[model samples]
Target: MSELKIDERCKSTLKKIILFCTVLFLVSVVGAYILARGNWELIEAQIAQMMEGVMDNLNIETNKNFGLSLFINNLRAVSLMILTGFIPFLFIPIFILVLNGIIIGALPMLTGTNFVSTMVFGILPHGIFELSAIILGASFGVMICLTIVRKIIGKNTVEFKILLKYILKKYVFVIIPLLVIAAIVEAYITPIILMNTIF
Candidate 1:
């Protein structure tokens, strides 16, 4: 019976995570599409400004810096969301999800093609795995924060320290591997594909 209860709870948590991630992703894509449509020139300018920074620093010839930077950035992003899960609320995960969705939606808009086509052609290579990692990381954060919130509300708490340790352990085993593979694909495979097809 206890095992059944635990299974049910895990299933419930998984549902919540999927619901939150989907909602966040969809809403952010719509919002960003509207924003990009309204201010395409502004978006272009902003993208150019950002690209300038990347270009100045990244040596495309070697791709060494690009890979390292991409990996570090992904690691940092995942770590930031995971660590911030300590505070009770969905804000951090929602923010990360929305931000990522916005960026994803907006990037294809800048290319002057339909968003679906652009995303399919441009981002699909690394994006599937990379976005999965990001969503999973954010979902883990949401789960942690929601668990904390439930405990505070009910005052029948799971020991936060123990919960946190479990979260950390699961994250190391689950999310890190995804992020690493994503970083590797983004750094190595994505550029070459983009160069040939999209860029």
Candidate 2:
């Protein structure tokens, strides 16, 4: 196929994959919320422990260098999602996405706070960019797995090298920038908003 046609095809495939991941993430969130409602104490403890572990790892004592720390942490996470695509059948990427969704869904219940307001003021500001980057990364990861499956089945597929180049190009050009903006907003603006409105 011509380069333009190939690019178009990639874009189309990416759109489908992104949509699939988005739906999966949403379902996971809703499922977790329902489950949490049924077993609030257990889920709350689990979520709290997970958050503690994450905070410990982040070691974010103050907001002075919070943006840089958060950016690096997010970069590592999204990069891992992409790397895990090398595993066949999209297992790891899906797990990561679902786990993230579960955490988000459980957050309001865990904090014993207003669900709508907490999500609106606490998560949405940075979540828009952060979640978009995450979903995009996971979609690319799924694409990698699909490419591998196609190659195994002797179907016509873009060479792995070309696919990797395209993924990396998009990661650097698109995902990284989104994450950078997300980290800045989450570290600086999100806290301020939450302090004023939610907290």
Candidate 3:
């Protein structure tokens, strides 16, 4: 399918959406980290349980299959964000982003490691690509949600089919590739780097 040409106004809106999502994610992370500090033991246990549930759901068996598993998992997560755009006011997609931020923010305390070191060695290598893809997907999701809201309010808007086509093209052309690279780095390169530097 041909890529849809986004007008300057739409481009500006998408940029604003991305910025808002980024700020929301960062705020959630910082807030969760600060809140967990006062009652770390309980928060740590809850985080552990949540992680265990996620791992169990993923059914990841060993390091050999981790990259593929992680890719699938991340794809499913971002897809959900896109799909949930039908929800009014972008509630579900926004909630998903914030929830992910909280989990990531708690990782340092959960591992009992230095925050900067853990983020630098363990998360940043893959997180840059992974987070970018997720945020992009979510921004589009939020855009979709906003379009629906506009239509409901009888405002002039692009056709839903055209907007959706544009988003799908972006997913195929942009987001999926980033996730693939992120999975590879997270599974192989990240471990090697951590082994040498932190572990």
Whole-model Cα lDDT of every candidate shown, in order: 0.71, 0.85, 0.84
TM-score of 2: 0.94
Better of 1 and 3 by lDDT: 3
**Could you give candidate 1's per-residue lDDT for residues 1-199 as a string of tens digits?**
3544554565577568867797778788778888888888778787556546544654455567676667667777777777677777555877877877776677766667667756766677777776777777777677778778888789553455555666677678877787777767878887777677766
Model 2, 1-199: lDDT tens per residue?
Answer: 6666666777888899999999999888778877887899766778888777666656367775778888888888789889898887655887888888988888878877776787799989999999999999888888888888888788887667777888999999999999999998999999999989978
Q: Candidate 2: list runs displaced more than 4 Å.
A: none
Evaluate model 1: give its lDDT: 0.71
Provide the global lDDT of candidate 3 against the true structure. 0.84
Segments of candidate 1 deviating more than 4 angstroms: 1-8, 41-61, 111-114, 155-162
Among these predicted structures, which one has the highest TM-score? 2
Higher-TM-score candidate among 1 and 3? 3
By TM-score rank, best first, the candidates go: 2, 3, 1
Clashes of each: 0, 0, 0
Can you give the TM-score per candidate against the true fold? Answer: 0.79, 0.94, 0.91
* Clash pairs (backbone) in predicted model 1: none
How much is 83 displaced in model 1, in angstroms?
A: 1.7
> lDDT for model 2, on a 0 to 1 scale?
0.85
